[model samples]
Target: MDAQEKIAQILQRLETGTCTPQELQWLQDWYDNQPALPMHTFRDEAHKQQLKTGMLQHIHAQLEPPVHVPVVRMRYGWQIAAAVLAGVAGICGWWFLNNWQPRHKMILVQVGTGQQKELLLPDSSRVWLNAGATMEYPQEFSDVRTVKLDGEAFFDIKQDEHHPFEVHTGQINVQVLGTSFDVKAYATLDETQVTVKTGMVKVLHEQKGLDVLSANDQLTFSRSAQQYMKSKVSNQQISEWAGGMISLSQAGFAELALTLENQYGVRIRFNPAEMKQDEYTLRCSKQLTITEVLDLISSIHPVQYDIKDKDITIHRKN
Candidate 1:
């Protein structure tokens, strides 16, 4: 059989899942080798639109279940090859316009201290950016969907099995097909944390797979030690900040101070170093003012605080 007939048979087998791994690899190699059509070559807007529609229709048909059709003989191998390559070029051109073009320009979302924001990505995925967080994403996703995050955010990714979603945070990467998760990776903090709420995610550090997390799973990577810890957490408790709630469980004074600072946009100072070691468990709504929250903290612990403008000083009570 000629190359065109062989390729058509292989494609049919691929659709039916009967193609061998080697055959699949061969097809991929062939596609990768095909020359891409230059965008400048399109003569007019109408011509470009026509080609896009045809390519999209062809792609959609391939994705659907196979239908029986009689094979038509072609006289010249070169003619059949040219026709196939032209279709491939049209597909490439469509993708270039829809995906690659938007990536040249990125959109940035930055949440200042004590300010939180919500974002809707090009793929309709939702993101809740926490205080002092920054996220950068393309105007549209290409073959791979990726976003860069600094600080913290909660993501509810739209499902797309063909294109996986990835979040890049400093040294670590969180990857998923479709899932809800929270990531905290402050540059000043020694640890980076990822908490999964639904579906599954793969955590990678320096291109190496560190762990796979399912619903309620949490992964903490220590920057100083270059080690990671994985554990289970209450999924409902994850990303409580998104709901305007601050929840802590047996958290130390240092951590509490950090949380308060981020939530209230204040600088906290401890009078004594020993106070940093103090631990407490608490939950409070963001609706309460910083003073009220501190009062509650004082009631629970033997401490007093002085607030002056945006600065707070905490001291142990005698």
Candidate 2:
């Protein structure tokens, strides 16, 4: 690749938290070797200075924190060199870095209510995001394979034993070499859950190892109680949501309410009452409308529901 192409690749890897030590050193060296140019080389000083500042700001804004990739330091007098090169090199340097490099920046995907999306990560892993879920990843992944998650998603990670894959939910971290799993860690919920469908995974909290789990293993961490529960889950139970189905067993009102809110994008409110059912069993299609789901749910219990716009209310029936 040409210098511009190589630089773009390096920057992409940097943006994705995958830049290697050698590539980083090369970037530093490239900046260090820029020939100093006199101020008069540029057409206008004020205009050049303004453009330079804007370009740097834009580049920095597109980058993740320096903790992932060290910030490239510009040598003294490099500003004039940059301005002159950008003007004389037919938009080869700074201009190219700003415009052409954006293709490699961080990317965010969000699914709204009553919708779902499937995506392929740079590492060839597949992800299915449920409604009201959001995930952020890079346009390309290099040495590191990682993504940030919120809400719920099912991941089929590609294998790269040398570079383990990681999913970050604010409360916990899931790491795997190659695995298919489902993660539920919606910010509005009181617990985060991980259910493995294949291979193995390690779950951590606050940078400390919590537990290592294998296929058919489920780990639930309660945010409020700061406790962990380990259980066995069926493959159907783990992959049902991805198949547009909702299956619950012995689930309480809060769990059911959150599921409805996520799938339907509605705010749910319950009256003050005992909301737990000893025989709480629910199975339905996510294709059902909010009203239909409510109807089905109420038929199994003595409860009433009302829907107004995006808000839903559930109360015990007398």
Candidate 3:
């Protein structure tokens, strides 16, 4: 087999726990033989940031207790395995995206933290997701091109008048014939929002029935609003997060706190949950300083926060 194909097989073997100790030794030796590549050097640029976000997770997996150790140790080999896996994963991602012809009807798309992923559905529709997002679909489009999403996703749907595309987000459902839209349905966010960039969409709240939204229309449902509020959205306001942007409308302090906690990999808690009702807007993307985001929110609402290591606490301005 070719070098790339061989590496791919080895990586799969490793993931499936089928590689023998001797095989692992050879794999490790392969990696150790090559000069170490700085881990940070692999950070994907701009559109490829999603790959960088999950680097830590992959690294952790490397340290996982091995199923077995080889009787003969290859000097300076473990690093080689890591390097090989990295190369294979990069190749696999590219191959998967460019040459996607899987026999399965449904394909699953998963992205790691600080990671963003984009997929072209079986129906020729496109979907982009923010950090920590996942999407699952049939390998092939049977009767419908429906997908289940957790976290957030921006879709550029292909025009299919016969079989419309539908996205199920636990509590709500968004359906479109041929429309471009974005959906943020994280439970942490009191409200779920779907902004239509093009065409039209039908937003159905199992609790509230059908809400139709046209192009440039944004439908926001919050814990307080309880009903769909249709509003005009600035061009490019939604789907910007896929480009490393953070866009939140009518966002509360509680939500902001959670985002900060997620971004920095820290924890920030508020004394009274109600205090999070203070609404604000934030933009922290593209070389923007994180401190600016924190300071901006603090200016609007009088709040006190205590930083205990990576954990933070916020209390009312008392």
Per-candidate count of clashing residue pairs (backbone under 3 Å): 0, 0, 9
Worst 10 residues of 2 by lDDT: 84-93
Model 1 compared with the native: what TM-score? 0.67
Q: Which residue segments of model 1 deviate by more than 4 Å?
A: 1-101, 271-273
Q: Total backbone clashes of model 2?
A: 0
**TM-score (C-alpha) between model 2 and the true structure:** 0.69
The better-scoring model by lDDT among 1 and 2 is 1
Cα miss at 75, model 3 (Å)? 74
lDDT of 2 by residue, 1-318 (tens): 656678777656644646554564566567556666444443566656765565444434433346665664433324433443343332334435444545457899999877889999878899999888999987766455889999889999999998789999979999999999999888877789999999999999988988999999999998888889999978778878878888776666887888888787799998535565434568898878889988998898888888899988887787
TM-score-based ranking: 2, 1, 3
Report lDDT (Cα) of residue 294, candidate 2.
Answer: 89
TM-score of 3: 0.61
Minimum summed lDDT over a 10-residue window in model 3 is located at: 95-104
Ordering by lDDT: 1, 2, 3
lDDT of all predictions: 0.78, 0.76, 0.68
| TM-score for all models, in order of appearance | 0.67, 0.69, 0.61
How many pairs of residues in model 1 come into backbone collision?
Answer: 0
Scored by TM-score, the top model is 2
Candidate 2 deviant stretches above 4 angstroms:
1-104, 272-279
Tell me the tens digit of each residue's lDDT in model 3 across 222-290: 755666678898867877787887777667776676566545556777765658557767776734544
Judged by lDDT against the true structure, how good is candidate 3?
A: 0.68
